[model samples]
Target: APDAPGATLTALPSLDLSRPAWRAGFDETPATVLADGAAAAGAIRRAEIATCIALGAECVGVAGHALELTVDHARTRHQFGRPIGAFQALAHTLADLTVTVEVARSAAAYVTRCGGDERSAHTLAVKASEAAVTVTTEAIQLHGGIGFTWEYPAHVLLRRAHAAAVLAGTPDQHRRALFALVDER
Candidate 1:
């Protein structure tokens, strides 16, 4: 072990149970006798980005499912002898949510098709993360009182959105990176 190059791996302790999240931090302590530490570091960074992209897509999928549940509720829940979804206001809001989910899905699909481009992948991550939060929030609002209760699945989707938004990178951080990318062009 002393003569050959090696990398150390450590499993960090859990942070807290109040919030559902996973985090790991690495310190790039100098590796003695290592010829190319930079290359290893770069590979690790790429892996992190790839993970972020995958999680972002997952968040989008979660939001899409939440949307479907809300729409179903709206269509079936009747008020004044008519389905609530028949109302123009609720219908329009659901339509807009559908558009957001579709756009986020497209961005996610783009990232899958072009996995080699880190910039586009990060862009998709940003879009999907934001879309998840926004769409989930809207879904909760559409679900009315029941959505606020812990017994309902809408709150679960909202909690997941909040957790995903902060994972890998915040929406603001990703937006800054996207702006920088645009500036570079």
Candidate 2:
């Protein structure tokens, strides 16, 4: 097959880091010498947005589960002859976490329904990533010392939230993207 006019295919070695990240570089060679690749840049962008959406959804799910675990722990873990969850501070914190998780879920679902809307996808990714990190961190706090230990799953969820937040695009980056889109309009 003939190479596409404005595209080239290069085989570059890559390294995968934590949270599904890759590093690759294209050579500075002239385009004439490289094999042309299919798919326009727009198509690639759309695919990347789709990937971000899926990753955002995963983060939301993780946050949701972590919230559930924290809630259950609060309800069952007794303190002062009563469940700690009965305390106002703990109850309010749990309520906030629940709201964040729900908002993140709504954002993810909106992006999923919107198909490949780049702005919406970016916003969703940012919101979901932030929610995951916040919810997971709060979960660890609510779990007391047990959350920090390896035996508990709070640490695992925190690590995943951190990783997911960095992947696709960081919250700051997504925010900037949203700002740019708003500026364009």
Candidate 3:
């Protein structure tokens, strides 16, 4: 990937996230043939599966961390002579976010330990992307003005989740492919 023939490695415009454009142009450009036979296909399949699993795990981590930060902030930052977390609405939202992060974590861990099939990757992708993006966005809102600033981690997590979601195709694309695979069964 670092050096491949017929691949321009054109850098896309700056992303909102901090990640470098490590993957691009393999589809559009007729890159040099890395492999061709059935064995090669199998290797590629395995690689894609690994990538998807890793991405899902990464999203889980991101969302979990963001949620932790938000919860800490809520507990410490007070409103109307009480901690923000004491408010019923915020406490409920945090509870939901906690569930979301935990569910994604469990799914990622299950797929990691069970050696799940190709279709499992898509399911994990949809869940992880949704959870990570949702938690980080909520973190940003809950953190008030501080969340949007570079000083806080919420914005960074949001950007990371957004960027990672597009890597193995967006969540919606994966959902469609997952349904197709299921229907094929």
Local distance difference test scores for all models: 0.79, 0.83, 0.85
The better candidate by TM-score, 1 or 3, is 3
Candidate 2 lDDT tens digits, 1-185: 12444335544432212344333434453354232345566667878798789889889988998999999999999999999999999999999999999999989878867875988889888989999999999989999999998557887888888877776889999899889999999
Q: Write the per-residue lDDT of candidate 1 for residues 41-128, one digit (tens) a residue.
A: 8887788688778778888887798989989999899999999999999999999989989988888888878864777777777888
Which ranges in model 3 have alpha carbons more than 4 Å from their true place?
1-7, 22-34
Which window of ten consecutive residues has the lowest lDDT sum in model 3?
22-31
- Put down candidate 3 lDDT per residue, 1-185, tens digits, no spaces: 64565455666654454777744555555455778899799998888777788888889889999999999999999989999999999999999999999889887877866777788787888889889999999999999998998756888888888887777778898789888998999
Better of 2 and 3 by TM-score: 3
Worst 10 residues of 1 by lDDT: 14-23
C-alpha lDDT (0 to 100) for residue 143 of candidate 2: 95
TM-score of every candidate relative to the true structure: 0.80, 0.80, 0.86
Q: State in Å the error of residue 170, model 3.
A: 1.2
**Candidate 1 at 150: error in angstroms?**
1.4
Report how far off residue 141 is in candidate 1 (Å).
1.0
What is the lDDT, from 0 to 100, of the residue 62 in candidate 1?
78
Model number with the top lDDT: 3
